[model samples]
Target: MGSRQLESFVTERCRSGTLTVTEACHLFDRLLTTRDPAPTIYPFNHLFTTLVRMNNLTNHYPTIFSLFNQLTQTNQISPNVYTYNILINCCMRVDRIGLAFVLLGRALKEGPGSNPGVFNPLLKGLCKDSRIHEAAAIVLDKMPKLGCTPDLFSYNTLMNGICKMGQIGKAEELVDYMVSKGLQPDVVTYTTLIDGLCKKGLLDKATQILQCMISKDLEPNVVTYNALMNVLCKKGEIEKAEELLDFMVSKRVQPDIVTYSILIDGLCKKGLLDKATQILQCMISKDLEPNVVTYNALMNVLCKKGEIEKAEELLDFMVSKGVQPDIVTYSILIDGLCKKGLLDNANQMVQCMISEGLEPDVVTYNALMDVLCKKGEIENAEKLLSFMVSKAVQPDIVSYTILIDGLCKKGLLDKANQMVQYMISKGLEPNVVTFNVLMDMLSKKGEIEKAEELLDFMVSKGVQPDLVTYNILIDGLCKKGLLDTAYQMVQCMISKGLEPDVVTFNALMDMLCKKGEIEKAEELLDFMVSKAVQPDIVSYTILIDGLCKKGLLHKAEQILQCMISKGLEPDVVTFNALMDMLCKKGEIEKAEELLDFMVSKGVQPDIVTYNVLIDGLRKKGLLHKAEQILQCMISKGLEPNVVTYNALGCTAQTKRN
Candidate 1:
């Protein structure tokens, strides 16, 4: 074919998606052999652009790069600025940003010095990889050297990236820098800052930025409003979110489907499904069709409330409305079904997802695996994991973690360890939560030293020990009677800026109580209160039981009264402790009065209650009263256990004696 004919053929083939990469190379060689090469850059640019449009850059880059190399050998065609731009974007898409800069040098040496479009892709890639500091350096340092003057879009990209990295402070500085450079921040810039601030829980600062945007006549769009509303919703400030929604409407910035979806999601998260439903209806009334996200939000709430039938009905309603369910939709339903112990329905949902051509992603498989693991079907979970690999849907960290957790629960530590190794081989670094799960299992199994070693290993691997990690370690050490080590660990937690929470305090107090260090436990309780760690019911119950066991009934009663004074109503267990102490002291009248008090407080006595009261009355030779108590226990629908029968038999034997 002539050069012109070849170029036309390639363009048409590329447009029609009929040209393979190899065929394009053959056609390019034919064009180069022609006396006149009919602008090979155009055909090459078209092909590269087509590859980008396919959104499969990582898969296609090798094939396209091979063709580029062949054309370079011939030296019959040179890539223009457009060609470089396409190539730079392709590199960014695959996170091969370093290659993008090398190409930028080639473009600079060739012709048409690099521009923002070339560098923007690099910034995007860096931001996506959370390399925001490097991205900023490129914007502020490298771009100027390349004669690429960073524009508004460039600054906004950097700002958005910084915000996503959770460095809202740095983002604000970037905004200031943009202002100093005379590059005006637009709605996108302000909205990005607002989102970053809100996510950081600096909602007041976010509101100030929103107000600043309004003052600049930027007139916050639906995106800006949605960002603010999303933050408010997540903070459980539903009233504020509702007010913001009303303000957005009052401002006449016509709420889009995304705006309504954000509001619905916020309400659903706050467990206000009825309000979320109202928003859905309002959106429908306004002729704004609810998308899959909107339906998924409602369905998630229904599933969590264990209203699986209602969730399914919402799914049907969505399908009827021609809103197709994505992987998230199916995953939500599957998770809900699994939580409700309807494993069969969950599996059927997976099948339905497959039948509808919606391939179950890792999340879908994780849901199934999690259910199987919880049900003790560990072998079945492993089979499903193998199936996931066979289907080419690579198991993620969550998938391996689920199986590891299941195996650990089933006491298959060796197999769980193998799965961890397998995950590492697959290049998946176990996250802190995954490490925590394994560590928890080890600790519970009395492998304190192994658990400690694992903790150290996770730290070396760059997984920062969170509160849960320290809690697990401390709990394990306490259980092993390594109380001094556990106490030192608490000091380490404080040094690490992790304030001891109620769980941490409870663990310590329980150990002290067990060791009969009542005075020390009391001192620790005081210290915990001083540290602003309010003692939970578990903490009080532990102390009360400890005092009662030591025959310090008055002290235990004092603690009980203290709990009540703090507005903490004693549960049946708490009352039972005090009653057991009184019964042992032969304070039969006091014990009876306490029982009446518990019943008046609506704390229904259990089998333990009847057992203690009957034993005390029988010891005092009140066998008739004890029998009457047994009749009352039966009438109260509390089943007496062997302890109750044994105590009554002792009373009869004593009466005969």
Candidate 2:
């Protein structure tokens, strides 16, 4: 075949993703010895460049470079800057920066004869490799010397590199230089600086630069506004960001995909998911397509807010729109499903990703394992762990923590400990959540000292104790009757700037009540209400039960009424305690009244409620009322147990006397 025919064949094969680099080179070699020698060098250079672009030169760099050198030696064609730049880019892509620089030195030494096109690719390679300083030096030294004036693109690339390096001062200096050279900073230029400042968390500085850009009569483009909005939203200045967005719309700077993404992410972070959905709808109305980042941000927020159904809907919408779901999208849905205890759905999503030819990432495995663990499907979680390892997907701390927590919650403390040991053996450090789970499990088993010891160990390991850590330890100590110790822990949590949540307050109150310190429990309850921490059902129940046990029926009744006034309904246990207290106090009428009130309020009385009333009536020598209640209980499909029989027999004996 002619040399052109060979080149066409190689190009076709490379584009097909089926040709090996070696085979392409071999075909090139055969074509070079053909009768047609004129087109040989260009075809070979084209093949080598194609290989570099295709990212198929991993183990064949030396071969490609040697072929280029051979083309130069035979003088079939001279090697230009494009060929060398392509090789440099290949080196950078493979993280071989040193080799890239060697190519750079070769290009620079090639002097005025070399094509200045080399500088563009070189700068791109250096910037991508985070060698921004080197790239900046090249831009300063090479472009002018080659008589190649730096374009707007070159300046933007340099500025972007400097900004990403967190050298905003240097980036500004370059921007000023670009303007002084009569090259005005365009939207790309300002956007880069704004993005850099935002990334470094200098929102005010970013805003100032944006204002400066606007003052320069250079309108803030979509990118400029999007960057500022993203930073502001991230910094929790969503309102101000929205205001700027309003300005953007008024100025006719149409919001792009990124603009919508920034606002969506911001709203989601602020728990304004409904607003986020609105922005997403607006984006679609504007004909802007929601990208993967946009969908992932929306999915993440929805999942976190326990809006799993909406999140799933979004996932389907994204798929129907032909926006491929990345690992992040899958992971978000998996975590949301797991959190909602939908393990089957979560697993199906994972399998779906795999079936779509996307390998499950570590995050996918971790999320699935977490759901399985929470569902008490420990065996399935373990199976997933093994599958993760088998598939070479390394398990992270989240994976192990999920398993440990599941085992601990299932009362498999020994297995949990073994897992902890396994994590340590594998050189993976346990995070705060891991230790919290273990300590909570130990505390529930009444191993208060062990829980405390683990707490100390966690702190010693430099894992800062968060609110959860404190709450678990305090709850454990309180449950073990170590009220003083638990209270001390509460103080420590406050000292650390962590406020006690309602759970902490309730635990403390319950501890005090169990110790017969009803007055202190009441004080705690009052303090909790004062703190604006609305007492949950457990809080009211504990205090009410404590007062009732102390024969303080009036106080118990007052608390019950207070709970109702506060929009908290009493549970079955609460009603039973109240009835028992009233009956024991010889107020059978009041006890029956409370039962009627409970039923009237649509609170179904459990068997315990009826038994308490029946026993109380019989004890008060109301034999007819007691017998009527027994028959009423049987009619209600509540079988009379031994307590019921005993109470009835006692009433019958008293009646016979």
Candidate 3:
């Protein structure tokens, strides 16, 4: 047969999907040995495109690269534009865009016949990788030189890329550029900007763009409505999202699976599970099938509400309806079961996942490990870690962190430190939480120097300590009575752009109050106010208790008035401190008046309240008043504990003497 006949046969076989690996090899041999001397690029380009298409179906993207290399190196046939386009597409799909660009440069050098078809794939690949700047450069600067002008698709691709990167302003500018070039902005262009603005919380601008699109007579598609609905749902504007859904149906734009999924997820998040389920039913009635994501949303909500059995039933229901359960389904159920202390059932879930041929991912293993660690079953958690390694599933930093936290909780600081070193050896740099957990444990054990060493190590490893880390260090230093060191640490944290939170201020204030440094504590309170950090109830309580202990009852009373003026209602602890002070001062009638005030303020007196009053009255030899207070305590349904009995017992002994 002639070369043309052989080429035609190859094309027919490739197009019909009848080309096997064995047959492909035989056809290449015929092309190579053909007596036509110099072959046209037709056969080579045809074969390459065919191979790429077949690989795409099977997800064998790497195979396309290997085949392309073999054809170029072994065969002396020059490739055409079609061949380059197919190879660029294959490279892009396999995340080898760098290699795709190299082929593109080669194509540009060969010159002419390069069009939007050749360039659009590269634009899309770059856009998908979030290389919007590079993609825009190619369209504006490179396209004109290559004799390939930018089209509406080119502008759309770049705008979409920019929007995804949250540069909505740049996307809008690109749209203006497209319009200036006499290219009309379509529904897709408007939708892309809307989605980006919505994600960036610039919903007003997104709405304006939607209005502009409508004015331009560009009818919004399902995708456009879906994007807006998604944003509204996320913003917790369920009512607005529902109105939009109604409007979409009124306009006869059919709601797809995504529309229902978004609405269902929104309602579920708002804790309206019944409403979410009704949306699910409405979707089914409309002949739309619920996918794994739709079911996963419901299952997640059920699990969170502690309705695990209902979630489990939903899982079975989905499976019965031919919807396969994914890793997320099992993970949610496992987490729920673990929280409920159903470790045995959670283990069974793992086994069930494996039995269904779904290999448990790191997330699944982490969930199980975290539960075991919390239960003080570190040994069992270690065994599971080994099992994960045996299955060739690499354990993530989360897995190690869970184990470290477990060891720390069990007071095994040495073992936990060793685990941190092991994590480093495995090249999994400990995150801020990992370091914070270790530092917190070490500091609590009176190993402040060791905790500081860990902090330095974390800095050396390029892990910036977060607010939680600073708070932990501050709390630890305060506990150890290292006030100067703790103060210096707070200064350093503030200088590093970390604002001192309520926890930090409270820790310092508490330490000062306890050390009788009332002056310094008051100054700290002033500083906190200047910094706009409102003093909480604990702050005022600390001051009141400190003043009362100092025997300055008048000052303490004034502070209580100030706390109440600031809208910080004194709690039971605050009242107990004042009552105890009054009883000790032999002012029993004044203490009784304070008790009446507490009751008027709707603060029920606890056992301590009654005990203080009864002890004071008994000490004053007012035995009848003490007896009346005890009877009132009994009437309030408060059963006296050992402390209450001891207080009354001491009073009775004094009376007998």
Candidate 4:
């Protein structure tokens, strides 16, 4: 057959959806032998397009590349932009992104009436590799400059990439740009944004986006509802999720298996197991079978509540329903067993998993190792590591981290350092978390210089210091009374775009309080509030304790009232600190009233409270009253420690005086 006849055969077969891989290749091979009237690029485009869409057992990508190369070199036909797009797509799917971009560069140079479709694959490839900025640049600059105006596909692909990488602001900008270009936001666009916003915990904004989509007369698909529902469920807003489900049903959107699963999972998380079971039954009544994901969620909640036998029964139920347990299912069971300290049973579960031909993954191994480390069985943990290596399961960063943390807690710093080195040698670079652990331990041990060195080393290694890293250094400096240096570290973190969180402010406030710089600590508090960092209960307690120690009873009481105004109920420690100061001031009557107030407010006083009251009575020359208080404490079932008797010793001394 002639080249055009061969081309027509391939094109017809492709268009009719009857083209087999073998048949396409045979025709392409036949075309390469054409001597006259060579075929155009249309035939090659058709075949490559079909091959990529098929994506079967064979490596059709390499075949596409090979056929393109041979036909171009041997035939008199010229390759067009269509051929380049296909080749670029093929390169992308195989992760040869560099080659895809190279093809793009060649296409831009050839300049055959630039096609936006040409850059879609390139954008997709970049996004898949997490090269988001480059993808955005191509959409905003390269495509337009090359006369390939950004299309809906181009915008959607880049937006999805941005959202995945936690760049929600940029994704929103892309949506605005999409609308400005007159490409109305489609269902996919709305769904992607909602998913991103939901993931970022911007649930209210995500709901607004949904409302906007509805106003625009765009019907949300199951994917859109699922994304929003999943986040709401995750936030433990089961009631909100149910309301959303009702709204979804009102709009004629059917609740698929995923929707039911999400509802079940959400209810389970809120400890409403009966509600979850009802949802599961509702799902089954609709002829929808529950999968392992649905069962896993219920079992996980049961395990968390320490109802392992109930979880086991659920697992059996899952299996009877023909839903074979996967790795996640077994991992949950193993974690449940480990948490209950059933080490032997946990090991047996692992064996059972293996017996069912499911190999335990890194997560499963990490879970086992973490339990072992916490139990102080370092040798057993190390043995598990060796077994993992024997099974060809290379340990990830978490495995080494767990061992390091265990060693550090046991004061085996040298062993922990050795493990860090070994992990690095195994080609796994420690992330921010690993460094944070090491720095925290070193700082606590007064190894401030070494901790500072680690910060510098991590920076040099191209790992930017996060808030936790800076907070550690600041706290370390504060503990050493290096206030100026700690302030400098806080400022440095700010310059690095790390805002001072409540923890950072608290550390500074604590150091200031310790130095009797109450005024300065209060200023820091104001600064934290101005910066929108609300002080936690610890922050208030520190200031209150500092004022109480300074004998500023009125000022301390004001701080206590302020805390209460902010809805922070004073804990036992806060009350004890205040009562101790009152007793020392010889205001035993007022201290007694404060003790009654704490008890009436449901803040139970401990032995410390009684000791303070007894000591106050002794100082007030009321030995009989102090003895009656001690008897009351004993009657209340509090075991008096040396402090209680020491107060009586001081009472005898007072009598002698």
Candidate 5:
């Protein structure tokens, strides 16, 4: 059979999808034995090109190369432009740009019987595969010497490749070259350059190029405006992007679905929900139906701003508009519900996704698991985790972190630790938040040493500790009566360039007070105030109680006076402590004065306050005064507790004597 018959046979087989490598090789071998003087090049080239296309599709580059060699060397069949195009496409697909260049050189120099047609495929292939420089070299230098001129497709392809490579300078030069050679760049050429500049975040340059294209009488297409709009929106230039949209419509360039979607997403991200809603209305007004992407963008914004009711309303509107919510839509609602601590509602939405035939992606499950874990529903989280594993949804670092944090919060430290180990075994690294959670739990359990070891482990793992981590450790040490160690930790935190915040100062103050180091605690309190760190109620309360416990009643009174002077009004606990101390020292007059001052300040005395006052009067043998205060307390709707009754009974016993 002739080459035409052989090619026809291969084309038919390829289209039928029944062609095998062994069968093709056999057919090509038989065709090689033909002794026809005028061999038909068309059929042989077509057969070879078809085989090359098949090999490229299957990513069998080597097979395509071997076949190319067989056709040229074994069969003595001349290669054509079509043959070179196929081979270069394969090379480009495999990212073998250098090998593609070598083949282009061979095609340029060693044409079919040393002709120019062989180089046509090489140049066309380079252009199609976006090898701009090689195409330019052949078109500008080598092809002209061979008396071959590149067509408009080749020029446009070369321009696109150059622009895409961000060598816009060279691309502009190529455009100039094309115009000099009596060629005008079409919309594709301009769009390519415009898209290229936009991708590089050079919006101004892209706009300049668009103006240049317009000056050249090339009207901007929907794609041109879309690219510009997307770039402008991403840069937070929404007003300019909107102006462009108006300009596009005025210029008779219709906006596509993507154009509206981009603007909606941009406005939603900027928290311009009203503006986003306006754009959605405009999109519908223009008879351009909003897509799922548009609805999802609005939904995500509403969900993030805690507008779940509005988000759900929009979702219903989306469904009514015949736009189905995709994975992103479900994920947004799930995440929102989870954040609001409504796990059951979140799970129902997830089930809705599944009922709609949408398999929950890792993000959907992770959000659900996070909510369950955060709500201390570890059993449900573990069950979901098992379901995820069974469904082949591999657990990422976040999944492990959520579970670990939950376990630690529930005081299941050993299980939490095991999870950390499991995460490492799975080749996932625990992040800073993970360590902080574990450290906080350990500290709360009085395992200050273990918590410190974890902190050290975090450092060893190259995870830098944040302020919360340091505060947890300091508070733990202080609670365990290790004031010096807690103080040293504060120094360490400062050395690490982390300024001690209110929590750090409070921890230190608490430690000193617990250790009876009232003087140091007062000094630290002074420093805290000077640093503009307002002492919280706990800080003032701790210092006051500490001084009173040490029998330094004058100093304790001074601190209380100073606290009030600083506009820090004492709470009920503060008054109770002072009263308890005064009554214990038998200072009835001073104690009564404090009680009167407390009442004058509108600080109603609680049961403890009344009990303290009654006990003080009874101890001083002022039974009449003590009984009168008890009656005043009862009349004021303050019930006498067991302590009050005991104090009153003591006064009654004294009265009977």
Candidate 6:
């Protein structure tokens, strides 16, 4: 047979999946030895592609590299762009990304002119490593300059990676760019964007995309519906999720395990344990048995809700249905038991899981260690850290953080600092939780400057501070009366897209009020509202208390009425502030009337309320009226403490004088 015929024979076999690694390699040798007219690069490309496909099973990746080297040495045939693409795929599969880029540079400079097909795999490698910005630059800018503009597949790949990072806005922008360059968004594009929107809790935009897909006659598939349903379930819109499922069924799109699992998890999160169980049964009736992931999702929510008994029963039921409980299942129950303060039960669970040959991972050890630490059993928690190491379970950030937190709780600053240094030395950078703990420690000790420096250190290490970190620092700044710095930090967070939450606003407002900047505090309340942040009870209470302290009785009562108008009933503290102001003005009757009003509103007055009343009546020399107030306080099953006794003692001393 001619070289072309032989090459065709090999390509046909390789493509048909009948070609073995040995046979493909032998055929290539025969093609190479037919020296009359050596086989074209087709056979070599096919053989390389075939070997790369089997790389996962036979570890033939290195063999492909050696064979390619052999082909180059033969000088009978040169590698084609297809050959380079296969090599790139192999490099990516083994995570040799640097080598893949080197091969790409060679393919661009030495091989036949590059095409979008050649750049796609390189894009995939860069994206898989989360080198998104680099990937975007190559596909959108670098490749097009080489006359290889990104195709639909190329755009879809970048979009998927961008979506995975929860960068939905950038993904959408890429879609517009793709369309501007004449590539239309497909179902995969829409589905990926939906998933990203769901992650960011942008349900309205996701649903709009869903409708847009249907409007374009692209046909919303099961994946699209699952994405939409998953978001709905997460938002506690279980009814809407069910309606979506019904809509999916009406469109002849069947719900898969993922669709049902999302629903089950959503129901579980909403504390509808029974509803979640029914969905599990429904999926079973449809012959789609619940997998380990489904059971874990259900049990995890149950465990989080402190329903350990229900979670255990679910595990038993899962096992009875021949579905094995995995490590996550046991970890969830163990965590729940530990949180419920059932350490012995947690230990027994560990032993039981070990007997079943399921080794405890770092997460399992963290759970046990956390409970022990919280119980102030730091020594026992420390031993657990060592025991996990003995079992070949390496400590993760959480394990060390749990230990450090225990030491911190016990005021072992030096030990906790050592643990942090040890983790850093081991190449595990501190995550937001670890940094938050450190920042809180410094902030509480009035080390605001050091805490801010630590924030800068965290950013230098590429760890972004979350809202909790900002809240801690802002609160610290407010405590140190660094109002200007605190305000600057709030603006900094807003610029970083970390919008000020109620905790952030509350901290700033309380500080402003303390500095007698009540007007500025009121302006902040208006600012938070303009930003769509609803003022919570704490926010209202702070304003009322602030006004009352400034002796603005009429203004304080007006604020109280405004709070009630907004459907926020004043708590005892709000009432106590108002009554204190009235008592200072010698309006004992008005203060007593305010107490009766608070009781009528079902806002139970604490001992502080009774003490305020007794102190007011005693200063007015109405000892008999103070005694009636004490009797009233005792009648409500309330105990009088030091403040109550002090007020009554002054009344007796005044009578003797």
Residue lDDT tens for model 3, 1-657 = 898888888888888887866576677768866775555668767776677666443465665566667667754676776778788887887788889888888777766336666788899999998888799989888897778888788888898889888887888888888888788988888988888888898878888988899999998889888988999999999999999999999988999999999999999899899999999999999999999999999998998899999999999999999999989889988988887778889889989998998888888888889889999999999999999999999988999999999999999988998998898899998899999999889888988898899899899989999999998899889988889999999999989999998889988988898899999999998999999999998888888888888888899999899999999999988998898889889998899899999999999999888888888887788888888889999999988888778877877887789
Give the C-alpha lDDT of model 5. 0.83
Lowest summed lDDT across 10 adjacent residues in model 5 is found at 112-121
TM-score of 4: 0.60
lDDT of each: 0.87, 0.84, 0.86, 0.88, 0.83, 0.88
Give candidate 2 regions above 4 Å deviation: 1-87, 94-99, 112-120, 130-190, 212-218, 235-237, 268-273, 297-314, 515-657
- State the lDDT of candidate 4 residue by residue for 283-382, as single tens digits: 9998999999999989999999989999999988989989999999999999888888788888899999999999999888888988898899999999
| Tens digits of per-residue lDDT for model 1, 575-628 | 888898899999999999999999999999999998999999988889999999
Tens digit per residue, CA lDDT, model 5, 1-657? 565666577567656766666676666666666666434555555555566656435555666677667767854567677666666666765667677777777776666313444455555556666667777887788666766676666666677667767787887787788889887888888888888889889888888889899998999899999999999999999999999999999999899889999999999989999999998888889899988999999999999999999999989988997889999999999999999998889989988999999989889989999889888899999999999999999989889888998998899989999989989999999998889999989899999988999998999999999999999999999899887798899899999999988899988887788788888998998899798888887788888989888888888889888888989889888998899899889998988899899889989888888888889888888888888998988998998888988887877777788
Off by over 4 Å in 1: 1-185, 192-212, 235-240, 271-289, 305-323, 552-657
Question: Model 5 residue 236 lDDT?
Answer: 90
lDDT of 6: 0.88
Model 1: clashing residue pairs? Answer: none
- Every model's TM-score: 0.67, 0.76, 0.63, 0.60, 0.52, 0.61
For each of the candidates, the C-alpha root-mean-square deviation to the true structure, in angstroms, is 7.7, 5.9, 8.5, 9.6, 11.6, 9.2
* Local error of candidate 3 at residue 403 (angstroms): 2.1
Q: Which stretches of model 4 miss by more than 4 angstroms?
A: 1-21, 30-46, 53-60, 70-84, 105-113, 309-324, 355-357, 370-376, 389-657
Please provide, for model 6 over 452-518, each residue's C-alpha lDDT reduced to its tens digit, 9 standing for 90 to 100.
Answer: 9999999999999999999999999999999999989988998999999999999999998888889
Candidate 6 regions exceeding 4 Å error are: 1-244, 267-292, 306-324, 340-345, 348-357, 409-411, 553-657
| lDDT pick, better of 1 and 4 | 4
